[model samples]
Target: MSDVSNSSRTTRKPKGEGHSRRGEILTAAERIFVEHGYEGATIRKIADEVGLSSTALYMHFPDKGAILQEICRDAFSRLIAANAAVADEDAPPVRRLRRMIDGYVDFGFAHPNAYRLIYLTRPVEAREGAQDMARELGGGLFTTLEATVADAVTAGDLKGDPSVLAQAIWATAHGVVSLMITKPYFPWADRQTLVDTMLDAMFAGLPRP
Candidate 1:
């Protein structure tokens, strides 16, 4: 519940448990990446935050880049899986699209730290790391989204290039996530109400088929 972009020490987990230790490392690395950015987020920094030594961290991950990639892969993989489930629903494509969008926004709110680490880091190194991710999970995330958009177009419920629509829709959702996360001080409407209003307004703007 505290800020993920802070170097807060977590309670140290036991070393022998690989899964839990990996999770702790990831949780700590998320905070380190945001607090220090990619170039600054050293293995030592992450290890210290998670209560591990650099050598112990290496046993779990090769380097900070690997750590970053794993974090991004998990986040994007979960999102894509959630969207895939939405895609399978017997609802209308446009309505199913709304469900997918809802899942995306819910992720931002539920795991703001992971979201920020994936999308909002500012350093050049961080951006490059994100770009590299595009070849893997990041690319898959967009491809999945584009496929959903294309389905909507094919269903005769929306009119637009699938790629463009997908990008625009994603950018709009990202805007909501980034703004809400970065500008928590701003006076804003209720969270769900604002999200619903924004989504409704966006869906209304789509050219009807």
Candidate 2:
């Protein structure tokens, strides 16, 4: 009985060690994937980076595509959560829009690597699928803006299609934030000036009596 109990403990040790090693490999894969991108990243390199055999890395993730999907899904879920957090039904449309823009910019800055991978880098087929996900995510942000626009329309602060107005606001903000990320070293004369200018342009184009 004593010999059998000792043998069982030894048998379980390798299994527990394998699980921990797999977790370490996955964490290393995420770091490599972020630096090199999905296509450029290799299983062998990830294994080497993690101090594991290539076969061991494969044991955790079947292939590079599986790792890519995992990263994309994880990053996107975080982005969706960030947007959802700032969406306030009770806030006025303009205020809600402001808060959404702030949240988006902060999220993009905070997760630059993930943001670039999810939003900036993609092949044509992947791009289309990502665009679809972006639209769905946008829908969450747009719902609040649309409702706010409806309120604005009722209050006579806006006019015309609320849908169009919502898209227009999204475009304006996206342009500014995307540019900021894509051209980090851009010699814009004044960053704050540009932001203020864009806001002014947005308000100017808004419905007026």
Candidate 3:
């Protein structure tokens, strides 16, 4: 009986260890990717960072692109979850829009490396359909924004075509977050102040209720 119990414990331990090791590899890979960019971050480098032999790293992830896809997929999933919460709220369109922007900015700040990996990295072909995953996730978020903008337009709380307005708003938010992430050395105001200023500028000419 004791032998069986020990065998069971040994079997469970590797499963837990595998998950923990995978997570460590991902964390190390993210740091390396951020510092070196995708092309420059080699498998050997990531393995070194995680204290794993390259062969062992490959046991967990098939290739570098697979690692990147997993990182990007996780990042987009979090963003989608955050936006989905705002989308489901029973609130006025204008209020919902504001909340969504706030959430977007906060997410970017909280996960700067992930944000940079998704937005700042130059496009490269991804294995495991990473591009499709990103497009599907991103499209859902954009649809929510467009719908909110359309709602605001219908209620006379804002003006302009919903599709165009959504893109414009997205561009403005992207610019603000991109600058915050890529130009951290620049002398800048408080993050909240910058966000408020950018949002104010974007909404300046739109009709408000």
Best candidate, lDDT-wise?
Answer: 1
Stronger candidate by lDDT (2 vs 3): 3
Clashes (backbone N, CA, C under 3 Å), per candidate, total 0, 0, 0
Clashes of 1: 0
Give me candidate 1's TM-score against the actual structure. Answer: 0.90
TM-score top scorer = 1
Tens-digit lDDT string for candidate 1 (1-209): 22443446666676468888888888888877777678788999888887778998899998888888788778887888998899889988888898999999999998887898778766576655655765677777788778888988998889989999999999999999889987999998999999999999999998877
TM-score rank, highest first? 1, 3, 2
Model 1 local distance difference test score:
0.83
- Give the alpha-carbon lDDT of every model: 0.83, 0.63, 0.77
Worst 10 residues of 1 by lDDT: 1-10
lDDT of 2: 0.63
What is the full ranking by lDDT, best candidate first?
Answer: 1, 3, 2
Task: Give residue 114's error in model 2 in angstroms.
Answer: 1.6
Summarize candidate 2's per-residue lDDT along 1-209 as a digit string, tens digits. Answer: 00111122111125558866655555555556556766667888767765667786677788766665555566667656765665645766566666666666666656555565556666652452445555565466567667666767776777878888878877787678678867879886576677768877787788754
